[model samples]
Target: MADKTLTSANSVLLIGVTGLYTVPQQLQGFSEDDMYSMEAVDTAELKMGADGVLSAGWIPQIKTMGVTLQADSDSNTFFEAWYAAQEAAQEILYGFGSVTQTSVGKSYPLLRGVLSSYTPFAEAKKTLQPRKFQIKWQTALGVPI
Candidate 1:
């Protein structure tokens, strides 16, 4: 008998893309940072209505993505990206997330999106801790994870 393909996996997504915010990730390339660690905890969700008599339909009005991008590089690449956008008063460069499951060897594609916030901070009075930036992305398509 043939073996069944396993479905279990790990690592929701890795966000390390850069370039024009309005452009898709296909145009731009994901950054190559050895120390950077990017992870997506929350994926696009259905814009459902409040609990009602009937079950909530799959009519997702808006889809969004939330990511946690962390890096220990002192070069300030993260800050520079946000600073450039802020200085020009334009939308910042977005990322194209690749949701992958190592166990199953499957990959899920996520649309590009802009960062919700542009502030990276470390806990005050902390001893040698890397700063984690919590950013949100606005995507129209739903994520398949």
Candidate 2:
């Protein structure tokens, strides 16, 4: 029988920042939708000429990655602190991170990542909602471990 692949077990997401948070730590406190999602901002644009000619222009854009975690997660607190430090810094500090799916032996790395957007906090009457964090990354295709 062929080897059974395609598993999410033993996957981890880690983040780090220079001078502030140099050590990369695993981000926990994830919600049910804990999978990290990545999407390309734009692909290629194509046009057809009147004389039945075709032209295409490929635009290289940053990839946007998003993750959802519980509001009360320690990971959220770490992110908040990281953001605060960035805001208090004299210069911008980009984040360095990586996500590895050990089961598949595939890893996605973020060379230079910017925390594009995130919800500080949100709460209902007696319930805590999950917070979403979006990151803009300049990443290439996933490589083998």
Candidate 3:
């Protein structure tokens, strides 16, 4: 019988990005129903591979540059704001530098997973707050010799 050791592995690459915006006064004018009726924009979609890897695709938009309130609730509103911020950050980090388009079809290593954190609060209120998400995987981006 052959013995094998089971060890946990952590991916080598973790990327993250972020955006910020002040809540607009116009939003206050809308009634609760109107506010809820306002369609929440779809920022990002995540896909997972059979191997338990994850990848995310998102529509790039300038308006999405900042966080926005989702609903009138301490929890939901906070969650919506945080969710947008995290997605925006991820989009920036993934789109940064000259390296873009990370997919299995491109011969890149299989994506491991897309992990994100959500925080709700006024950006100005939190002077020392961190707003970013990271991807975990094992691979390098560069020309091979």
Candidate 1 displacement at residue 39 in angstroms: 12
C-alpha lDDT of all candidate models, in order: 0.44, 0.79, 0.31
What residue runs in model 1 are displaced by over 4 Å at the alpha carbon?
A: 1-55, 61-66, 69-76, 79-83, 138-145
Candidate 3 residue lDDT tens string, 1-145: 1432222121122122223322211122112222211123556888899999999998643211112232333333433553565566654222111122233212122122222333344345334332322232223234321
Clash counts per candidate, in order, are 0, 0, 3
Number of the top TM-score candidate: 2
Q: Quick one: best lDDT, which candidate?
A: 2
Quote each prediction's TM-score.
Answer: 0.47, 0.85, 0.19
Which runs of model 3 end up more than 4 angstroms from their true locations? 1-110, 120-123, 126-130
**TM-score of model 1 vs. true structure:** 0.47
Best first by lDDT, ranked? 2, 1, 3
In model 2, which regions exceed 4 Å deviation? none
RMSD of 3: 17.5
